[model samples]
Target: MNQVFHRFVEGIVRETDSNQEEREDLYEELLSHLECSFKDYQKQGYSNEEAMRTVMTNFGDERKIGQQLQQAMYPYRREMMLGLSVASLLYAYGVYLSQLLIMGDAHILWLVVAVLSSTALLLLTVRPVSSLNRRLWMNSLLLIHILIFFYGLLLATDVYHPVSIGLTIIASLILLLAIVLVYRTTIYDFSSNRQRSAKDAKRLHFINITTGIFVVFVILFFLWAFLFFSAEMSPAVFIIFIPLVIWIVSYASQMHLLSRQKKKWAYSIAIIQTAIIICLIGLWLLGV
Candidate 1:
């Protein structure tokens, strides 16, 4: 009966005129509701076959039910489509931006990698076989991106010399983009969203502060290193220092925030990172 029920839901999904995500959500909700109803029927002494029959009867005409569900999902379908369109536009613009910003004959490679990354993201969005499959796809997409980012950074450092106008523009754009992305991500905590006390709120605030500081540090350190080695100290180093300022500002802000929130544990972590940064800087200054 369970197998038959799955087949039934899959059939409904096939007949539905909604997007993949909506269809999947509809299938899961319907399956869960049927399971609950089936259990209730069993509790009332109905046999498995009898319960299955009752569930199907209560479910009404599967075709009509699917149509209704599809109709109800129209608004969500539009929103999903809109979001997809936005991503597509962003991907397209980002690729072209790279070509214009990055000097050399590497734009061809950039275009190829960008297309592949965008395609992977698109397929991951629509393909719905299993959670494991989806997770693998997501991981692969992230890996592709990380590799591409590193490759680009390498090109910027080694290939693109005389780091002047184009490099400055690229660094500024990247910094702007990084700051925005980090700000958006740090605004929300993705881990363990359970309810919490005032301390938890403080911890979350502390985490965001640390994250912002780290993000700035990473971006600036790379940019600084690149500019320092390339011997182009115009606006690149200046732009990098903006994030440096943010590092100081973020720490001071965090210190005040943690004190207010009474999350003293964050202080230890902050001190540890500060010590490491100071040590690394001292060693670097000493030509280590």
Candidate 2:
């Protein structure tokens, strides 16, 4: 009610990772508890300012209390994800720089992706959105992060330095940890939202796995063509990426549709894109 109590509760809620509704609930709960303590102090003959000061002092430091509440509520999951994800990104940057040194050129696309991924991760880390939107954002970013890091690992092999080798090993481990954290985070989100059914859970798992496999296959197919056979079909090598871009666009559209629960449209998009990708792959194989 008063400024001091309001600010104290606000400080605690600021340190938490919660949706808007949960945050409001937490604020009210904490404020009510403090009010009760303040009233009890008044009943024992303390003045208003004295009661307020005593209440705050007994409650302890706002930062420490907030952190403890955050840990109690989330068990350091957010902290773990943020730390590991940033470390993984740093490892990626290190490996990419090494590739630049070894090959005398770097893929500007990877640099752009790294920048975009970092921005997205930072937004997700600091801003709290609805449950559905948060899940979608996290799912999309983590998938792209894993794929790009894997490609970076492939490029890391171009260098033979001890530092590069060690960085690669550390990066690989970080990648694994990121993947596990993403999976567990997804599960934790689903559990927190008790309205989702077992069927929805299975569908999510299927979509994630299918999407990962489809995108990985597409990337590998293009890499194989460009790396091993580009000399023979140099003209067509760049052209092949046209279909890859189209496939990627289709995938993005499918994900949007799925997020909106438009399963029929999403499946239609996937089917058409797969057919187009297959035709493009056939043309490339035939040197067309």
Candidate 3:
């Protein structure tokens, strides 16, 4: 029975990419189930061969077990993939819109509306509670992308500033980082042990909330400076926001989902954000 359990566990590890703790738990559960089955067979006065056959048969199909495990481990994989695809399409639209904004052919009011709408759609898709909700949000994202793309084509043929190009580059990078972090954190939480101490979890949550608020302030400051103060857009702005957004998003997701695990990635993201802020401020002070 011990040898059978060992072989069963080996098969599970080989067939799936489950983390060490999960694999062990699954192995133990299967062993317990099999032991119970063998006991039942013994009560029926079956021979050893008959008992083995009965136990194996009662265990159900191995493939079915694998499928069940996969479902349990990754119930959200499909939703995540769908969200990623929507984000990518929206990003492509943003690229188009940037080109239009550069060409000076697109109206600023329309561009603002399109960008804001697309961003809202992206956020909505990121947290839909159901498949129907996700589909609706995805459709909205796709529609916004199409609208932005056409608007961008019109702008590309018009006169616009080169500085707009730099701003677009920065915005696109931030959006890309957002998509990557979302995908990675979602997948990691699904696969990792992610059991952390309450103290650690609280600390992580605090960091996430604080950093997220800070990033929101930075974003608002930029918006205010550009729209209200009439400040010229600069590459430095991108340097500041890209890492800030990445860190905040990563920290928030980790705090919410994987609070118990050692969050090395979250800390690394924070450090990167701080470095970028310092570099941007230093450059501005030097009159560059």
Candidate 4:
């Protein structure tokens, strides 16, 4: 294919969210059609450059066509983003109300998290799907926020206010729905004709980042316990740090694997690490 046709396909493919493999397939298919059309135009006695122009003109505007193709592939994308944005904002308000009513203090960190998440979701509604490098950031933030809410619920005392409890429950439910939306979009991304290694690499990277964030939060919690609650560094404390150490090591291994382009091994490590985390969280919830 000529440079004109190749560049045209490239333009369309850039507006798509398809992975490398799928993009190549699309490029080939579009190039074939353009070539066939050019030959037909040649039979009509048009010069080479004139034939190229005719083919391109008949194909329509590359950007507009690309955008349309994107919409066809992911029809409800804007709606879902908008819904999640509204839900996140509501969840943020609930968090603010609950903290004020229960702790009698502003939980600035969590409030910022909710608001930022909401803002990000809102912006995503306007942004093209292909514009974002990775969707991991939004999903990671939501997952962490959900866990924080769950932990708060677990640590609740009998002295909790009814209004606060009500707000927390409602907020948690809204956030859970938001999570469902996240899962749906993620599944959509994975369903595309992407390479397995490529998809796994993205997930592994997400695990690496999320686990590091969890480690920081755990350390801060421990520091707060020691300073404010007069807690000692007992065996129990060390026990809590055990999994964290393991997670840190796993993070290092994952980074090494990724650097080596051993994506499959990195993915395996990510799954095991995630399983361990889920098990630990289950035990904590069960009060074991």
Candidate 5:
């Protein structure tokens, strides 16, 4: 009987990403409910196994419990996606008009906006898939973002180096194709599974912090290169790389924390990241 109770409680906990307190509360409630069911079963002269079966049956489906918990915890993601979609369309239109008014090529500006919009859409849409699909989409997006970063780098070097923009354009197109594929993949994987465990969430957060740090280092390294080795670099490099670095770092930290288990390390990483971003922005503003 004790073993039976333990198994049932473990099932509930496994099905939801409830915190320890919430799990404890649910366990107590389930125990009380099961105790009552057991007493009722004994009164009806059922055997111990039959009583346990009856108790388990009345506890209802673990999957349903998981679904309800997910809905309760993440009710805002869908709404957020909708808002971002609308905003992206509006921003794209505005950029189009600005390009027409400027009466010159605005490919780089439009591309940057497209990258931003696509990233937002991916975050809102691509998450919450089966493990296999999730990993695939994540890897594809990682490649796409890397390519976009390099595309900007190429554009910045074009004026000084005058290399063919053909390869850069081709890479950008391929990145767009990848984004489209991932977007289509997301539409089919909307059903919720069990939420990520707290520990998994924490590890993901750590990854984000590490990625953000890497971006900052990259940006600083390039800035130093441009200042000290002006003969080998162009000022345009800073313009494109700075924003790319900042955007990547910011979102990496944010989503990483969102997916992780809450912990002291999570909070500490967040504080440090915020401080770094603030300091960088301040220095940039002061033109230092």
Candidate 6:
């Protein structure tokens, strides 16, 4: 009976494909289940041979089970491969653009940053080790992507030129606005009923407030750092930073007010935001 049980376990081991640790864990689990079933049969007065036969019969199609286990273990493998492939292609094109924009010149620093950031992005997203890790990774990659792209854009335009810097600021603001709009709208979604929709909207208000404050702090820190690094710090940083502050504050404040059913101040902030954008556009045009 022990020999027969051992043979059945070996059959499963041959079928399973996993690392040593996973294989050992699976082996223990499968062995425990088989033992429980075999003991249950013994309690019914089955002989050893009869119990072994019943256990083996119930085990059923080890090959298929092993394949399913492998698939389950690697649920995100396909998605990771697809996303990483696309990300690589994008970075490749960015490299090409860098060379073309500067007439065969390249920004080695930004190129290195882009490479490292994309690699980290791929590794973190590949396995999703944990939910909190995924969220932190996503937030970090977003900041990395933005900051690197900003630097790359400046490099491509030849950062020594003020016009180039101004253009990068304008472009970054437009991009930031578009992205914030997307995040703001999408974060208040996916409800199956009106009650859930209302609840999600309420949650959206607080979340946007929290995210908005964090973003503002991040931008302020970036501005201070950039200024500290510059021997002769210019106003170009503020050209971008001011509008970003205004837009996010406006958007978040409006969302909060509307969520709390306060319309008057929301409209007031909306008007202020429009004025700020117009003033920034005027400054941008003057610089151009």
lDDT of each: 0.54, 0.69, 0.53, 0.66, 0.53, 0.56
lDDT of 6 by residue, 162-243 (tens): 4456545644553363244234323432122323235545454445444444455456556656855888878787764764
| Top of the candidates by lDDT | 2
lDDT of 1: 0.54
Candidate 1 local lDDT, 24-127, one digit each (tens):
67688778988999999999999999998999998887767765664464324423423432453354445455546664334566657756765665554454
lDDT of 6 at 185: 26
> Which 10 residues in a row give candidate 4 its minimum summed lDDT?
150-159
* Candidate 2 residue lDDT tens string, 79-114: 766776677667667867876786677777776786
Q: Can you give the lDDT of residue 280 in candidate 1?
A: 61
Candidate 1 residue 267 C-alpha distance from true site, Å: 6.8
> Which lDDT tens digits does candidate 5 get at residues 1-288?
977877766665555434444556667776787788898998999998898888878777766665565456445434444444444444344444444444444455646655575565556353443223433444354444544444443433332322334434543444344444334233222322344554444444454544443564456556656755677766577685765655566555655665665455555656666677678667876985
In model 3, which runs have C-alpha deviations exceeding 4 angstroms? 13-17, 82-199, 202-288
Candidates 1 and 3: which is better by lDDT? 1
Give the per-residue lDDT of model 4 (tens digit) for 121-142. Answer: 6765565465454355555555
Tens digits of lDDT, candidate 3, 169-245: 54444444443433333334334343445445545545554445445555545544554455676656566567555
lDDT of 5 at 278: 75
Error of 1 at 161 (Å): 20
* Lowest lDDT block of 10, candidate 5: 184-193
Q: Which one wins on TM-score?
A: 2
What lDDT does model 6 reach? Answer: 0.56
CA lDDT, candidate 4, residue 92: 63
Candidate 5: regions farther than 4 A off: 19-21, 43-47, 73-279
Candidate 3 global TM-score: 0.41
